[model samples]
Target: MGPRVARCAILASAALFLYSCTFFEASVVPPGFAIVYGVSDYYPASPPISGDSYDLTYPDDDAIDMAALLVEQGFDVILRTNEDATMTQLELDFAEIGSRIEANGGSDTRFVFYFAGHGYGDGMDSVYGSSFPDAWDSYFDSESGASEPTGSGAFTEQLLLHDAMPINSISVQSVDDVLAVLDESLSDDELSDLLGTLPSSMQMVVIDACHSGGFRGSGTAADTIPESYEGWDEGVSVLDTLDAITLYLDYGSGLLDVGASDVGERQAIVISASGEQEFLYEGPVYGNGIFTHYLLQTPAEADRNFDGLVTANEAYAYARDQIVRVENEFFFGEGKFVPRVSGGAVDFVLFEAR
Candidate 1:
């Protein structure tokens, strides 16, 4: 046969072989890292009018367990729980994750980020908090037909850090400016004390129960919160969230240092405890957050292909099903903890659980 005819025959034969073969696709777990955060306690509740009464009971345990799980899977884990989780610290941790992945080399670098705690999603942004609850205003606004006062800086979603941070008062500045607020030694409460130490003329901006003030930028020092921070997959980049309730605050002010976040796209995979619009469940049943419990405990039967390796898709389905079943048995039927998974293809190897 002519060369062209022979080539066509070979192509057809190869296609047939591949179609007939039942190969178990093998995707190994890449050298990766993870950042896990969960808040079991929110010390400062929002105003009584806000109606954020319930404090999470399992996030601290969730963080600890998730970090351990990642470590078992051979991932470098950085864990933060309860009071240690502040907006500033969270942002820095994210940057550190990016740095670690880059240090290990980019491109094929893998990452798994897990958060088990309080999360709120307005029509636009999903707001996550350390231990704080969303305010009543979070539920409604003029755009949603509420008669409440209108304002700029409306958001689609944001992850809240620290405790009792006003959605509007969140900082949205550059990482440099955010870090400039103070050395990493300053805790959220210390941030408040930092303000107190400032000249009386300088205002203060509280980030959480630990910190309760804002800076107007009167002093030469960089302002914290409500500045500019970019990076990340979407929505508000850094802090720079609108501090809408400023009328009641004594913060001076800070700016988000200009520039993009240095943290690369380290969030290769994110396993949030709940969907953007839902709240995660925690109970004594599994002795941990609902999603987290299932994540670590789903039967090995989850290996649908029985290839000895569990893909992320398989693990997610298994965990989600188990979470629903357990939540229904123990909690109210109406309240569902819909776990969410985003970023990267679902076919990646999540765990080798052989």
Candidate 2:
């Protein structure tokens, strides 16, 4: 071949190789660390009564169990549970987790935060609280006669930002509260300012509840429901803003500059059990939140790539497919479960190295 032709061919080959390495088949292996927090029963209150009312205590248990599972796999874990553990306690735990991860070498560390409990949301933003029978109206200050409204409880993500955890994945199994916090936390420029301090890689959030309060019988069963409940309508908009954030981070200027890379390509992945208009079921046999049940059960089988490591994308795809299949087999429903994800490729290994 002529010199000019040979040069062109070599350049083309290099371009193809780079593209394959960056996009087609890229794998990341890193040390894993995690913090799991679960709130089964609220403090200063009796344990939640099962059978009569929905079992509101499972999420916390699931979270603890997941943390333990991670620990068994070789992850450094921080686990906490119960009523005495308020939102503040949870925040403190996350701060510690973040600090430790940073000290251990932030970029090299793969951090995960898992939470399970009652979550409340005001359509736009939601929060996970320490108790069941969450009084949305009372907390959001929607009821005129209610005592001073306390905003939704602390979001674990916000706490991580506060503590400066760099590059992590956060999986939460609260209802609407999960979405609410994501909506609000990612929107607030101040919150972004705090997050900007962390090293950029990827952040994943998994919410297991319907965004719309309109699920046929969801809030109707409780007579003492708070006024803030009004804001939760069925079919409310999905938390699409997260998607926008991912796109912006991928192409837009960095968090510091409009034209330069500011936050690195840090991604935020959100997996919700249902759309804003749907309902996520929690049957007695399911033993835990419907989404959580599916998540715990399905991904184990979907590690199709057999990389011995599961990325955020792989896990969500597995959960999404299995949730729909199981829901169809059991409920024969149109769309009882859905898992949505945003952000770039993330490294989320469900199992630790033995």
Candidate 3:
């Protein structure tokens, strides 16, 4: 079902003692466009394990909740979940939404692309895939003088399809023919919606509620999980899984450095649910992700400036702290999930600019 637009009114207290409530017209900000993706299950064989090693229950909830929030923000939101969250589907949705925004809006169009799902990471480049990968190829980059991965093809970053398979080279090339006009590369537009919204403008971002193995040149996600499943499938090695993470952490457009150079300005803020080397934990504590839970229901304490406008930086800091507190209470400090914020404009208006 599509996200129905409804008026969202938030009561802001002028003072604890006064108990007076000031309502915000949700429309304080112009309605924007949003396409959200969430996956509670992974394709291929999900390692038969229990507890935190198996399928999650709240990722889909997280997506729906975020969509509701976006709708409240006056966005025409499109929600995609489970098998529908394939890589190809993601690309197509962006292209279609981009076209719509291009035709009806201008550089001022606010667009948000959000995803909450499973993410695999090598120590360096993670290609957050919705589907689990069964293969990985590693090679050296002569120009960057670093080692990179080639999973199923030469492209560095990729998303998994509904059957839990990555889009093959032929499919990617074919789709690029249609998507090239936006940024001349699927990776560029895939990283962020280019054809529909301008990155230089406010209210546009690629916020992912996924995990990055480590923050740039550190460890991989393997360090958090049990090593037994490292070789669950004969063809898929743990290293291959590491190479499959597609969340773009690079300063450029995409993970492979094939990204659009102009995006280096990092016009908007992209929020990650956890840090590079942390696990994105989903517990029944709230039947949803802790970071996401806080992100949606941000504690009143987040209005640090007391200015009524919750800037991007303020929201991120507040959520990250809450994630840490909740995880510590749940895992007894054995596991940690810290959210991260990338791009710039920490002062960008996230909520009402009042």
Please list the Cα RMSD from the true structure of every candidate, rounded to 1 decimal place: 15.0, 11.8, 14.8
lDDT tens per residue, model 2, 1-354:
699999999999999999877774545556666666555554322232442332354766677667767676666788776553454565466567667767766866565545555433332233323332333323334533222111111111221111111111122233354333334222212222333443424444455544312111110011122222322224423433443443355343444222211111243334445543344555677677766776665436657677666666676677767765665456533334365443334445554222
Please give the lDDT score at residue 208 for candidate 2: 54
Q: Candidate 1's residue-wise lDDT over 145-196, tens digit each?
A: 3221211122222344446333332321333322322232233223223223
Model 3: per-residue Cα lDDT at residue 217: 22
Q: Global CA lDDT of candidate 3, please?
A: 0.49
**Candidate 1 vs candidate 3: which has greater lDDT?**
3
- The residue-level lDDT of candidate 1 at 344 comes to 29
What digit string (tens of lDDT, one per residue) describes model 3 on residues 1-354?
A: 233322221222225324533343233444477788877765544344332344557878888998987777667778988777766777677777766666656456667766666553332223334232222212212224222322111122222223342222322233332232122112322463343344325553434434331221211111223221121225656654654353234333355543232122244455666544345566787877777778776535577867666666777777867755555555533254556555442346565432
Largest TM-score belongs to which candidate?
3
TM-score of 3: 0.59
Task: Find the candidate with the highest lDDT and give its number.
Answer: 3
